[model samples]
Target: MGFSTDAIHAGQEPDPATGAVSVPIYQTSTYAQTELGRDKGFDYARSINPTRLALERSLAALEGGKSAFAFSSGMAAITTVMMLLKAGDHVISSANTYGGTYRLFVHIFQQFGISFSFVDTSRTEQIRHALRPETRLVYVETPTNPMMEITDLEAVVVICRERNLISVCDNTFMSPFLQRPLALGFDIVVHSTTKFINGHSDSVGGAIITARPEHGERIGFAQNSAGAILGPMDSFLVLRGIKTLGVRMQRHDANGRALAALLADHPRVGQVYYPGLPDHPGHEIAVRQMDGFGAMIALDLGSLEAARAFLNGLRIFTLAESLGGVESLACHPASMTHAAVPQEDRQRMGLTDGLARLSVGIEDLEDLEEDVERGLAAMKS
Candidate 1:
């Protein structure tokens, strides 16, 4: 089946008992057992829930992976993937990454004896130089958070495969609609379903999908052991959100590209960073790997004062931290999402105080443009 059909029908069937079209939420914590050793499909919610299982299966199919595991949050999914590596193992990660992910690696993971080295994965030589003898994984977020910088997935995958290292890509920004990392030879794909997958911004969830059965097993073990699985209600919500993913993504791409074009031509904007832009450094790679340019865009306002003025002046775009919602949101990475990173390091990664990340919504093009214009005018004043 095609992507749209899969989005609507995959892992979703009319409830056999009630004939309901939507997947029913099984809210129980435990299932009834006929015998001490046996139960009816489920033993415990922590181990497995019918609703959550359906969502997982749907995501796995969408991403073209063998299996998928849903988590309480994006960090939970990431932590589970990290748990696959033991103490003394090292990870080579993209220098520009999600702030929360960076904190997990630099702070929390180190406490657990795991180490990491950050490098610009866009450059093959940089990635090669960052790898250590004990490196077990190459982690990256392409079209990286706030910056929208693209990494060459094919190059990184080849390098990791040759070095016997796991290749994991965060597909949150592009989601399954725009890019499928597994099909591009990535060993594992991760998503913060709180964003695009959920589409509506109503739930917080995450998932990990993998083509390899062993990798799935490792993540599954960690998921069950850690007991950070998504709740049945949240799972149902995510499933509902995913049903319209293809449709929503079409609008997101159109709005994002249109906004990026406008920002690039604006006089007040110092620079616009979006893979959809022809002049963008990673446009070619993005065209090769993704079906659409995606909904995320970043702009440099020239200074912190200008950024603050633009953000505060915008009436239509909400000033908030999260992205990928149906409603437009604008945030400063230096203060909102990537604040955890040291100011010096964030500057090095191009996440300056003047940087503004916008998640373009499905709003009308004219309205969005006018909203952005108002903000730009504020910066001038």
Candidate 2:
């Protein structure tokens, strides 16, 4: 079936028991055993839930992966993937990764004996140069969080194959609809379903999809052992959200192009970070790897004072931390999302206090443009 078809129906057959169109949320803690030891496929809620399994199957088909596992949040999904490695293993990741990811690696994982190297994954050579004998995985975030930097996924995958390294891509920003790293030979794809997959801002969830069967089994084990699985309600919500993924993303891409253009032309806006822009450094590679230039955009206003004025002026765009929601949101990355990173490191990546990341929604272009204009207008004050 096609992408949209799979999004709506993969692993989402009508309920076998009731013929209901929607996958029923198996909210029970455990299933009853019919015999001394044998039971239905599901034994415990933590190990498996019908609703969450449906979501995992749907996401796996969408991402072209062998299987997928859903978790309580995006971070939980990531932490489980990291569990595949031993304590002494090392990882190389994109320098401009999401603030929470950076914090998890440096502050949490490092204390556990795992080491990490941050580099500009857009420049594959930096990733190559950072490799050490202990390095076991390369984690990348293309069109990276507020910077909107794109990495050459094909190139990185090639390098990983040569080095026998496990390759993971955070598909949170682009979602599977926009980019499928697994198709490009990535071993694993991770997502914050809180973002695009769920589309709505109502749920917090994460997913890990594996291209190879071995990785799938290992991740499945970790998912069950760690027990941070997505609850049935959130799973059902994501399933509902994905049925319209194709259509929603079309509006998001359209609005992103329109807004990026508006901000670029605005006199007060200093710099805009969006791959859809032809002049953006990663445009060529992004064109090759992505289905669309998603709705996320970052604006550099040159100072915190200017950013504040601009944010204050917006009526439709709420100031918030998360992205990829149906409603528009604006956030100051330096203080809100990337605050966990040291100021020096944030500066090195050009994530300044003046940088505002916009999670452009599926709203009317004219309304969004007017709201942004209001923001720019306030900067003059």
Candidate 3:
């Protein structure tokens, strides 16, 4: 079947006993065992839950990967991947990556002896020169958080393979429906299903899908041992959201294009960053690797005061922290998402005080554009 078909039906089947079309939430914490060791497939909820397993199966199929694992949040998925390394190991990651990921690397993992180098993975040469003998992984986020920067997955994967490093891609911005990094030779793909995957914005969840069974087994072990697995209810919600991903993505792409075009000509706008725009720095590569340019866009309003005026004037777009919802959202990366990163580092990554990230929604283009115009009008003051 196709991506949409597989999403709705891959691991999902009518309940054998009830014949319910939707996967019922198996809310039990434990399963009965015919023998001391085992009975059916499930023994405990933490190790495995039928609903979570179904969602994992869908994620695997969506990403064309060997196996998938669910976690409490996206950071949990990332932390599990970090566990794949130990003390004295080093990893190179995109400097424009998510703030939470940056915080985890610098404050949490660095204290444990693992080292990291923040470089422009979009410029492969930076990654090439950052390699150390201990470097075991190269992490990247195409259309990186806030900056909307694109990294060539094939190029980075080749570098990782040649150096015998694990290549992980944070595919949160471009969900599996838009781009599948595994097929492009990436070893692992991670996502915060809280956004696009669980499109409803009702649940907070995360997943790790590995291109190889070996990587899957390793991550599965961490999930089972650390026990940050998503609950049966949230897993069911995420599974429900996946069924409509194809349709939702279509609207997102359309809205993104409309908004980017309008903003490009707006008198108040500065540095519009949407990959779908022909003038965007990464437009050519995006056209090559992605099926759609997605709804996420970022821009600089020329100054922090101007950005505040625009943010305050928005009526339709919610001023919120998270994205990938049915409704539009606007956030300030310098203060909201990347606030934890030191000022100097955030500046180096191009997350300036004037930068505002917009998570354009599936709303009508006219309404969204009018709301954007409201923001621009506020800037006139």
lDDT of 1 by residue, 11-50 (tens): 8878766888999999999888999898777888999988
| Positional deviation of residue 225's Cα in model 2 after best superposition, in angstroms | 0.7
TM-score of predicted model 2? 0.99
Residue-wise lDDT of candidate 2 within 90-179, one digit each (tens)? 999999999999999998999999999999999999998999999999999998998999999999999999999999999998988899
Position 179, candidate 2: lDDT: 95
Per-model C-alpha RMSD: 0.9, 0.7, 0.9
Clashes of 1: 0
Q: Candidate 1 — which residues are off by over 4 angstroms?
A: none
* Model 2 bad stretches (over 4 Å): none
Most lDDT-accurate candidate: 2
Alpha carbon lDDT at 268, candidate 1: 88
lDDT, candidate 2, at 93: 96
For model 1, what is the C-alpha lDDT against the true structure?
A: 0.92
Summarize candidate 3's per-residue lDDT along 1-381 as a digit string, tens digits.
899999889888787759889988999999889988867988899998889998999999999999999999999999999989999999999998899999999999999999999999889899999999999999999989989999999999889999999999999998999999999999999999999999988999999999977888889998999999999999999999999999999899899889989998887898899999998888999999999999999998988999899999999999999999989999999999989889998888778899999999998889999999998898865
